[model samples]
Target: MSTVEPAAPDATTPAPAPAAAPSAVEVRETQREASRRDEIAPWLVALEALRRKGEPEWLAAQRDDATARFARLGFPTTRDEAWRQTSVAALARTRFDNATRGALDDALESMPAFRFGGAFAGREAVFVNGRFMPELSSLGKLARVRVRPLRQVLADDPDALCGLIGAAADDDKHPFLALNLAAFQDGAVVEVPERYTVHGPIHLLFISTGGAASHPRVLIGLNRNSQATVVESYVSPRGAHSFCNAATEVLLGDGAVLDHVRLQAESEKAYHVATTATRVSRSATYRSHALTLGAALSRHDLGVRLEGEGADVELHGLFVSDDAQLHDTHSKLDHVAPHGTSREVYKGVLGGRARGVKNGLIVVRPGAQKTDAQQQSRNLLLSREALVHATPQLLIHADDVKCKHGATTGQIEDAPLFYLRSRGLDEEAARALLVWAFAADVVSKLKVAPVRESVERFLRERLPAAGAVPGTRA
Candidate 1:
């Protein structure tokens, strides 16, 4: 009788479903708290040092402008529309003093060395802690292509330098960009003459070694019918704690073509914030590939503007994060001229308790008739605790333009995992195989095969044992 009474459905009791795992939201909150606490003292020191630098009058004016802007528009918060997915609170916590002029740091000795086998062997520039190192730099001149340090360029052509300083960073609202505009120490200037073609790739290495934050800049200009390839790498030793605020400005004239690639693999405790600003002229073609592999907190911002008709631009990016790292990418494409086209594809792989954010925006101006733009972002979470936020947006003012945007966030494919396992592979082997295959798309797009192989090797060395197949050779 009692069993029969108990069998009656209990309104307060229900069957328990599988429990969902906790996310990294709590970890992110903790990190934010730590960031805010550590960032203040350095900032005050930087402001005072910069005020006393006693640079040129124009430079002083620029610094004043930047300081005013920084005071007006501080670090972005989650409430900011463009920064909803990525918070700068941690960055705001500690301010970095202006990097001190010092000797080549010993901390840089442990960084991954840049090895050139072919194509890129003859063209190279090495910068240590935001300063060019002549002894470490080597390059064979290409016909009609000139590459030199920014200080040299400024001394040789002041007008060009002034133009580049503004061209590289015109964003008054962005504090970091303005700060870089006012405070960058030494940078690179690359100029490609009209109607000339560079057969070999040019490699630029940027190594951050000091504990102080440094700002490095690069200016690249291509004349009509010119063609060239540029590679930029950012790296540091293990567990190094520093800040890198860098910027690159590129201009492509009519019929010009450029292949630009940036590989960022810094120290696990470092902070990286970089901007790539590009303007494409009539009928020009610009292609860019970006890979981010390190840093405790890293943010990559890309701004591409089609300034002339028939300009075409393509952007591809990949980010891999593990441990407690935070990775963020903010990208924008502006179709300002008619008949212009742009395409963007971004992919991310996150493991452990890492967090990733991708925000891509495409805009077609009113007079940009027949403009075509496509944007896509895809994310893979290898751990239940990992978190990824993907957002793709389109703002089109032209009615006749064709524009599309898409975003996806998900875990690894079970079908692929099962298929690999069916072939006598262990769970770890299957997972590694799948991860490699997932990352291959971006790697294969590299213009040079050696670079692609190098990237693959880096991935192999960094990925978890479970995410790397046994006996696999990169």
Candidate 2:
């Protein structure tokens, strides 16, 4: 037939042969992919602005890597193995603007509650909405230790961060960590030279204001035989609905000792997520005191690697949740060398309809003989509506390792309550005394005086009844 060749279909015209319809699973997956994209788009937008800055090539490359990793990892869902018991859907659903300079309210800054005295006033790196504020901060006459802002290092000597910036944090598998690496504006960079001892504890104070998202980063390096203490604290105005994604990486050189304290007391309307990674060298010691409260939802991941012989790690964790708040803590202790020792204890106090979760894993690798690891999770539920979930695990590949894990979750024991009541205490005071006892084990681990006082103040403010206990102030 001499039929003229059909004109090619126009751009908008459909082809004569129709494509096969997508399967149900394929359709569902496409929707999920789109949702994930939506969740990450805001952060990408924020990163774009940061990329325009004249940052070092190496830092740019690191950010690019983190961006790719973030896209691949996406946001963790309850369907994921590690997130099965915790859902970040709310955090993922909200689209947040990147926090900017001048985000802190002047009136808020002048509030008596925000003022600090003693050690915190001595050496502090202050950040409001992820931007460093030198006006309100002081480096405390540092000698051999370099306690400067991350922005300073990124600009003055990015070479210093070549191997240290992203060393301990695993952004490849953790989306939040990747997000932080991609979007962090400024943070504290602490460097303690070998055989030196920092005069005082370095305080990293990060404040979150409502109406946006913040990314706070900290990189700490303690050289051989060096010693230092660091306190990473987060707080916000009451009723603020903000988002804070923080990451802290620490490297302890051989024979180094470091004490880390992390306190999170955000608004009940806020969401907080953080990751802390530490690598300990031969005979190095790492002590941690982690306390969490006040966020509507919060999750903290702590990972420690004993890279050389005789490395030791001791961790104390406490979480107090009320009014439907949810706190999730996940810790992993990896013993890679011989003669490693690790001890972990986490306690929880829940009231109202609150919930608490403690997930811990201790792994002893092959040839890591003489490894000793202990993990415990103790929880106290204050009401019938409160709930807690604790999962402690031990994975050992070496033959001569001593590893043990246990968890206890229950309401306040009647026996202890009765005893406290018999000691001329009212029901409320009695209950508070017992609760304090339950939490004292972990709270007492904070060695820094200012930190201890601050945490105690928070506990009292959160639970007025707890303030009436014997060992508390008005």
Candidate 3:
């Protein structure tokens, strides 16, 4: 679990040239369709559809706000200032067939990662392609907590929840977020009462079987002095080129705590765009760990806001990619109140022609004095073709704050590889060991044993032969 600096690449290798610009016809077609699709998926569309079916006013207003923000800030491309390093032009070519509204019982039963029966023994909510599967979901009292589908929650009491759901997501220029805002269907809602603590983790499984896109939203509320842990998983077993746009929001009350983890392992031909937003209150604690593998193109945006004094937050994440996979992460830690602390660490292992990007931003306002924040990103390249962009930024208007940011891009150390080989281990085994050890710093932080083990297995299977699991000697 060492946070060692990744070794620099040898000077002998040269970087590859950038891909050719996309065709004008292709770009124009996609942009036009994007505008149309954005409108179709906005809250106005959802609200109108719901109203025609006799829905409520508060929900409609929530939709109005979301749609207005969406319209204000439209889809973003790599050309945009924030997305300059992570080109999403490939998304324009993606055929993300929306997941049809149907019974996914068979898909759920046959899923590779759907192991909720044992590990997720308590109430579990299952969604295939973004729509809730009542039969697949086990909703009930779990470890002193009540769990139910979001649609049910809204039906019962929309006024109490609309603000929480809609307020968590603001208008991001990211197309994926815009699409999610427009197209999301049902989701899960977990409520923990005051002074309660859920002994086990709440598991939410999102599987994209095939056909249609999946936009799933999740909400969790922890009352004062309450504590809980949530694990979200996304997987696609059958289809190639599937698309998953998912979002989650966790609201922590005073003195509450939440440990959240998201594991994304989609098919090689798939595309994944996910966003997680957490708002922490006074003296609350929030920690998040993300493990991403697979997917031809994937991007995750983590936005955290410390809104009250004495809030503590940590974001630990890692992604291992190969075979032309593209992965990106953009995180913003906002210190809105004084005496809050935040830390961010992200690492990636890239091979083949895979590319990765990490953008970590820390914003401390003028009156947010006594704030402490640290951000760091590191990446390991497994091949000469691999590329990574690491940018760590800090905007601190507070004169009395302690903040620092750092980033690095490098590969496995040749000396370590040679030394391991001299000990009689083969080259492939030696490299794999080093790569695993390099990624272990983030993996070790996963509190859920099963989830952590699953991530390790994914890395072993996805990383190339040259990647070796470091020996116990290290």
Instruction: Supply the global lDDT for candidate 1.
Output: 0.78
lDDT head-to-head 1 vs 3, winner: 1
Give one digit per residue, the lDDT tens place, for model 2 in 1-474: 122211323425233344498766667778988988888777677678767468788888888999888888889988676787789988887877764555567325533464446466657878888878888787766777888889888789868788788899877668899999988888888889999988678888888887668888999999999999998888888877889999999999999999999989888998999999999999999999998976899999999999989999999999999989999999999888999999999999999999888999888888889999999999998889998989887777789989999999998788988987888888887777777778887877788877777777777666648656555434
Residue 124 local lDDT, model 1:
81
Best by lDDT: 2
- Return the clash pairs for model 2, or none: none
Worst ten in a row by lDDT for model 3: 1-10
lDDT of 1 by residue, 195-236 (tens): 999987888888876476777899888999999999988877
Q: How do all models score by TM-score? A: 0.86, 0.92, 0.86
Cα deviation in Å at residue 437, candidate 3?
0.4
Question: Which residue pairs overlap in candidate 1's backbone?
Answer: 39-93, 39-94, 39-95, 40-93, 40-94, 43-95
Question: What lDDT score is found at residue 32 in candidate 1?
Answer: 58
Q: Which stretches of candidate 2 lie over 4 Å from their true place?
A: 1-22, 106-115, 464-467, 471-474
